[model samples]
Target: MHIAPLSPDDPSELGGYELLGRIGQGGMGQVYLGESPGGEPAAVKVIKPSIVDSETRLRFAQEVEILKTIWGARIAALLDADPEADPPWLATEYVEGLDLSRHVASHGPLDALLTASLGATLAEALATVHKQGLLHRDLKPANVLLGPNGPKVIDFGLAVFAESSVSLTAANTVVGTPSCMPPEQANGEKPLTPAVDVYALGAVLLFASTGHAPYRADNIHLLFHQVVDASIAPDLSGAPEELVPLLTAMLAHRPQDRPALDDVIRRCRALIEARGLKVAQARRRLTNFTAAPAHVLDDLLAVDRPATPGSTARARAGAADVPPGQGESEPEMLAPEAAQQEPGGFRPDRQEPEPPHTPPMPPAPVPRPTDPRLLFARIDTPTPPPAGTTTDEAAVKPDRSRPSARPAPRGGTGTGGGSSAPRRSLRHSAQARITAQRLREAYAANSPF
Candidate 1:
């Protein structure tokens, strides 16, 4: 994922954590990279102001509750949250790795062994979630993070308690990616069960092996149709032989037909062991294939070096020499001119200076015209000609300065405002139109549209 610089609108601090930068944005809000007091990196998701209603707040609070109940190495543990805070936010352990979708797009689909490992890891993660009596509800490639340890499931924004009285998703409203959703979910069947996640895991595994979803379509409606169709088989042509049977069973149309999480885990492990590879070895291979380089973490944690005592003294003396209001918040390690020369640039062995505090200015009120008609009035004033030019000269003299009405020549400059060659003959124009029509017909016949 891309880490963007903090924008002016982004808060510098949230619930005692100092926000460093933006990680990404989602439907609910933005996820920012934050650092705790002890310098621990965290991923903080702040809800959007537009969604700060009572229902959304309750859902966010429920998400926090669901996250608190989940605990596993393959799960991103909830660190902190403030549902009551202005624009409620939740923080989770920042997994330093790319999401599974991005990983597959960058590198080709994982091999059989690695895919099996991912399946086992994610299955176990889902098992843990189910143990807490919660349904992930939205488990797809984008939600799974491939890190050093293994596959870690990250987002719980759409999770719900198995026995909760309140429903975050309204009746008959779909809530997940269509291609990865189970048949019942696509059909809006309730009440939902853990089997939905099992079916989604099957889709994820298919994507990991084939680099595309099982139910391929150009739009959501068709994809959802394919998912809900009991007779339509998933396209698993590219999946490994050992994985085909297990994936097929997991993606069964009926929820009861799908294997339990425990069975899924066992099948994945059996596939790995059958290939003369232990689960540990498979995990190491997965890490080697997907983990981010160590240098990336180093760069993320790097800080500016402290300045020398002599430079500090010189900088202080220079600051004292400057007049008040010339340069506010001048550093004690660099002169005002030098600092101004390079705004936000890294200086060797020097720490960056904090900006001086300024009083918040009240917003200026928008001024409304006393007469409403004046706002819609159009000004039609004409420009006065040059002093030497007369009105007749301006009127009679054709403005060669303006472009001609005719189309420009194919290869000649059109600035001279001269007409190009005469138009093509009627016969030739008719032939060109006929050729275009034929091409359009051919395209319409062959195109998916």
Candidate 2:
């Protein structure tokens, strides 16, 4: 199926699912390609705004409840639904294949054995549906999907529980495709049985074999008239002789005359076995022959990661963050000043290569002196005095009159080449003060002393 891009009027999200594209549209609403929270693909059917009234909502909710009871591989299982939502919608597993109608239209009719196998599979699927006390009121070629596994029935828009009392359609109003409808349904009969689906299946098989419905009319009225007429027989000229008897019985005018679903399956399997084709072999052939085109299946399974609207354009324009290893080239780290000058925080410039055979540069020398007193004096005054000033005046001016109690240096000489204790004491006091000041600065700066 052709999945068209989502239109401006279509919502980007319903519930929590991100609607990817519009897969198809029907009388009730549009079917969109959506992704679940866990990233699984789903077909989300949104009810039309015109049908969001109380009656339709109730019908849709009932359909959801009926679908919950159904469980089988042949049918597209309902994964989620929100009936109370504005324009209520339901989600189902997205089958990656084309509908049976489109498949047969594109590829010619199936052979006798393949047709029998197809009939058996559909019969079993309908049997499962009937077992759940549910009637797929709308069973047609469009509702049958051809996937990798085999044929799968989809779209329960008109499905109803057999025991339910609600009647969504008006009295004497007909639903479902006319050509595929049984005489009772065509005549607007109530309380439809499972046999009606068997009749429709026969019509579907007829279409598959002959490339057209058993009864075809240009207008709905004429189609309904032809379908309601019991005297008219379905044209099965193109159907295989082996399938003709079964197909005729299935399309019998009277619902009671139509063979039961179990009987239909038995007869189909017998036909396949008589043709020397195992049931499994025939199914494989049917699946292979009626499979959707490779490109179509690829499109259905090709899931793109969900992104916000306009994210694609932003990613293409390099406005979004590029994942680590996806960049064209690794970025080079720059100096603090250089990095600040760039547009973004990181620098985009590449580093230059060094010259060959060059000697490595030596590390810079430390500025600290061996003597603690000289280091303290440097710390006290980072800047030097005038160039012509004497060492005493430039460095430190001590009061010589004050006497020092401490001993002199080990060599019996002070730092300034004097033996005076007072000058030494003053130097020691200045050093002690400088050390204390340095420790306080380090503590305030949160740095190691």
Best candidate (score: lDDT): 1
lDDT (tens digit, per residue) of candidate 2 on 163-222 = 664677887677788888899988877778888899999998888777788888899888
Give per-residue CA lDDT, model 1, range 1-449, as digits (tens): 44556788889899988887777898889998888998777899999998789989998998898888899899998999999999899999988767888767755578788899899989998998899898888899999987656679988878877665456778777888888899887887667899989999999999998888888988888888888888999999888887899999999999999999999989999989998878977776676556542222233344322111112212222233334323222322211112223233222122333321221222233233333222111011013334687645544442334322223222221112222312222222222333345546656666777
Error of 1 at 123 (Å): 0.9
Predict model 2's lDDT versus the native: 0.66
TM-score per model over all chains: 0.66, 0.65
For model 1, which pairs clash?
none
> In model 1, which regions exceed 4 Å deviation?
163-166, 294-297, 301-449
Error of 2 at 294 (Å): 3.4
Q: After superposition, how far is residue 98 of candidate 1 from its true place, in Å?
A: 0.5
Give the Å error, residue 32, model 2: 0.5
Candidate 1, overall lDDT? 0.68
TM-score of 1: 0.66
